[model samples]
Target: MTAKLIHGYEVVIGFETHTQLATQSKIFSRAATAFGAEPNTQACAVDLALPGTLPVMNREAVACAIKLGLALGSHIAPVSIFARKNYFYPDLPKGYQISQFEIPVVQGGEVSFFLGDEKKTVRLVRAHLEEDAGKSLHEDFIGQSGIDLNRAGTPLLEIVTEPDIRSSEEAVAYAKELHKIVTWIGICDGNMQEGSFRCDANVSVRKPGQPLGTRREIKNLNSFKFMQQAIDYEIRWQIEQIEDGHAIQQATVLFDPDTGETRAMRTKEDAADYRYFPDPDLPPLHISEQWVQEERAQMAELPRTMAARFVADYGLPEYDATTLTQSKAMAAYFEAAAKACGQAKLASNWIMGEVSRRLNMAETGIEQAPVTAAQLATLIGRIADGTISNNAAKQVFDALWTGESNDVDAVIESKGLKQMNDSGALEKIIDEVIAANPDNVAQFRAGKDKAFNALVGQIMKASKGKANPTQVNELLRAKLAG
Candidate 1:
């Protein structure tokens, strides 16, 4: 079912994700699959379809496909055929591409993610193994175009999904979840800028309960930000066209990041237009159940499974669990900190809030975080034991980040951030504040919560912001009650 209607139109979206498999060599040849090499250096005889070259299946590519199928809970076809999708392009050296059709390696599955707190699942149609087409590089500086065939035969798994996504947000969430899965399982690097992963969105609109409208496919949405913008623009554009009495046309369009608009590239073609047929040069691909089981045995715990464990073992909220398991490195960091401090919720909060904030500012990944998990756990321990306040912890964190001190206690001592937990000292200060603020105390007794808060602020300020907040609240409530 559709998630919701946007502006009285039911938006339907499907995705086609091209995830380049992480193999050392091209799919059917021995050429290097490394990126940023000199153009055309990676193309081999079979990749170029030289007269006598015959395609050889890459065992590693098939293993990666099986791994993805297992990760997504998709069916692994025992026997799948390879067909030639015939198309003519300057970058296509073979004039045809070898891809799976009719019977794909991975049959059906679903990718589930949270759209805010609401759970959404996008069903999968199939994920097929295919060869990537080369790039057509247009150089305005030289006033010429060149074909870089280095990418021509790189192994790719084209993942397709049902039209279950409703909004651009849902579409992007689905994409991110898929990206995480492929990378988590070591299938794809999920690098959009390098074109290791690419997305094409099919968006359409109709009245509630009406038949699906003709759709336009947006091509080469390499970034999640651009993907959402493209889909949003297309949705608005389609709605505008329909409102003006212009019918939506089924075509392929390109999103120009420069103009923040989508323009028609060409009329979209049907499957029949591709003239697909089983390639005479290649044989049907076959996979064994034993092979699938072997892959399953070696696979890492999935994000969902790890998230569930986090919820159960750590007593974390479902949302927290899901957020923590976004990447393997992040999950490891949280678990290590939680284990060290014996406080799961506090660990989650610090990692997700303070650590994440710093990481975002630095534009770095969790793997690159300067503060070690053990160091964070030590800092949290100080906060828990009333050795420092949360605000003080931030100072220590900043110090740790800048390599000023790796030791949390050393930083706390040097900065004098230790919380004022001495009951005698705090009590004397509270008494003085109470005596000096007679009117405020009277107003607080008259049921003004703000007066009580102001008194608490005075205590903190008098203590030089080192008073333990929890202790202050408890003692002040007792003093007022008496």
Candidate 2:
């Protein structure tokens, strides 16, 4: 694939995602990890770093990291250490964050996704375990800011990626695929609105084949839409500056959705600037090979693996197989429908086309769809076995979706949608159509395909759209030749 150039400069992007683990407690404390609590109410002694309170690592957080490592096929380090990242913020009551620097629990992995027809792979640097800082609230108070410590100490897995993304589309695709994996594996809730999954994109643009340019980190992009917007705006801004004979500066920026622009928050800090040192209270985390294997054994089948099985067992196209397995619910729905109807391709088409369209329109997931897999399969079966035409099947599908009827056959019968499959009856209709349209027959013999189509339309109209289209086409050709 050719590199995407923005104003004669190639866009380079990397992502740092903070995935909030689904653990019940904080990473280093027993504070509740639930959202929407009163400010500072959920903060425990350890979370607040009160005197005499020591940090104790949560085992579940470690397990979550291990689960992600296995899912990404990353090397799960048997031993990894935690360090203190010195920082000062209104929300940081501890005056420093506990994070990993020199050693991380989950090391190098890669996320692969498709951007248009091109396959792109974004290499991972490391996914380190860390604690979240509290949020600063300024809306409620007019003259002062408020600190909400409830989110502090929330368990997080900071997944870092190499700068492999060359465009905003690729970056969004990578973010979505990563979100699917973390949620599919049940590690995080994957709710971007509630801050359960947050992404920080580092974007830079440089002349082709030149040294990498300085990067600006866009912080806390909670929505994919905003992530793309932020990157695009940042890329344009940097290019504009460079064109004006100004150098791009490295800094942390925030995207404002209201204005669709990015503003610098602060100068970007390097790892060495963090003053990293091992945490005195917490020991290095250790995992046995047996533990890693146990995690692997209990993990659900990965999406890629399931996609391969769909291609091999169901004979679906690669794109269809990959799309069907996008979410676990959708995959199960497709499998059930395919098995019931014994028409894998038809089922795949319906699910990917009509079913997906309706679901998206209603803003609902497959699990919440009004039409059940069995019901859809029954509809497909009718169409497959000549009980209904494709158009008629859609009528039945609408009736089923709107609760007009539950039984596929009942809907077809009530709507009088059953196809006219009798050979003699269809022959009579075709004979009448051909006899009535001698001009069309003459034109058809003169090599006009439209004339042939007109004859078929006449037959369908005579039968009130009940004639099976395939049978009509076959009988018309036979009669035309005779």
Candidate 3:
């Protein structure tokens, strides 16, 4: 999809994400990787790089990498090497981070998602395994900073993407799809607020047919809402700098949520500056075909695959299938409801409409929905069997949602909401409505559609809204024709 140009210049974006693996131990040590632990309690001798302590790779961390490769349809490397990414900081006890450089475990994949009904794809360069640095805390210290090494050596899969993103909206869509994929595969928990998933966006802008502009990296966007805001502000800032005759320099920048702007942090470093060298302490990692196949065999059904099944099996629209498969829980709930009620389209409509609306308003997830799938099936069944009208069914749903009643039939019975399906009984009311409203009858026969709706409304009111709307429309039209 073409991105709408901003100030006659097109936006281009790429992304790098750090996803903390779901292993219980750190990537290169036996230290616990649990969050919120006392600053140094979880940091072992290996993680702290004490003398004579050599790094030992965690088997579970490597297993997480294999699952990610299969999930993205990427190549699982038979042989990959770890390198020392040399850098210096207070929190980096080893003075370098152990990461994959020349030979990454996962290579060459694409993430696809829908942007306003148009499908957008982003190409991935690589997803390399790495170790995290500890954090520096300044809030609690005076004229100094405290270091928390609990996060150090935590396993991370650094996923990098090509610059195929065109706009902030597209970037968000791509991010969301990738997030869904990683969490769905169970490699990462995808808790952005807890720092399990973090994104760095490379944003630039240029003329429609011109070469790509120099890009700046916006670092550590933890939430999707903040991500879009940062990208947009960066796009405008870059365009303005170029308009003022300033050359766009390559650098790393930080987004300030309070200011809604990005400020330069430092110049971006090239690979040569990192002084990458293969780690001599550990041997090259090797994986056999059998290991990759084992992981694949144990994996759950992927989202896109399940969506296709939903379309073919349930005869659902592509949009409905895609939306329902956004999460595993959502998909399961929908399937249960569909199977119980025997009406796929009707179940989809209620789920996507009323169910979703209530969920959002309450700031809750589908799993927390007070109305169970079995309860929804019962309510839908009442509507299908002509035991209640749509309007009346909504009341029953509200009663069910708020715990007013546990049974669909009970709600309908107590409220006197049963539909007037008897043709003879409905016909008497239809005749009375026609006799009292002559002008509307003449207008209807004169081919005015509003007159037909007016007569239908009067019949519903006269029947105290118990009339089945579909039945009323059919019988009203038949009597008028006679």
Index of the highest-lDDT prediction: 1
Better of 1 and 3 by lDDT: 1
User: What lDDT score is found at residue 161 in candidate 2?
Assistant: 99
Name the runs in model 2 displaced over 4 angstroms: none
Could you tell me which residue pairs clash in candidate 3? none
By lDDT, the better pick of 2 and 3 is 2
lDDT (CA) for every model shown?
0.94, 0.93, 0.93
All candidates: TM-score: 0.95, 0.96, 0.96
Query: Which residue pairs in candidate 1 have backbone atoms (N, alpha carbon, C) closer than 3 angstroms, thus clashing?
Result: none
Q: With candidate 1 superimposed using the best TM-score fit, by how many Å does residue 291's alpha carbon deviate from the native?
A: 0.7
Report the Cα lDDT for residue 110, model 1.
90
lDDT of 2 by residue, 188-303 (tens): 99999999999999999999999999999999999999999999999999999999999988999999999999999999999888899999999999999999899889999998
Candidate 1 lDDT tens digits, 335-436: 999999998999999888989999999999999999999999999999999999999999999999999989999999999999999999999999999999
What does the lDDT read for residue 132 in candidate 3?
A: 97
lDDT of 1: 0.94
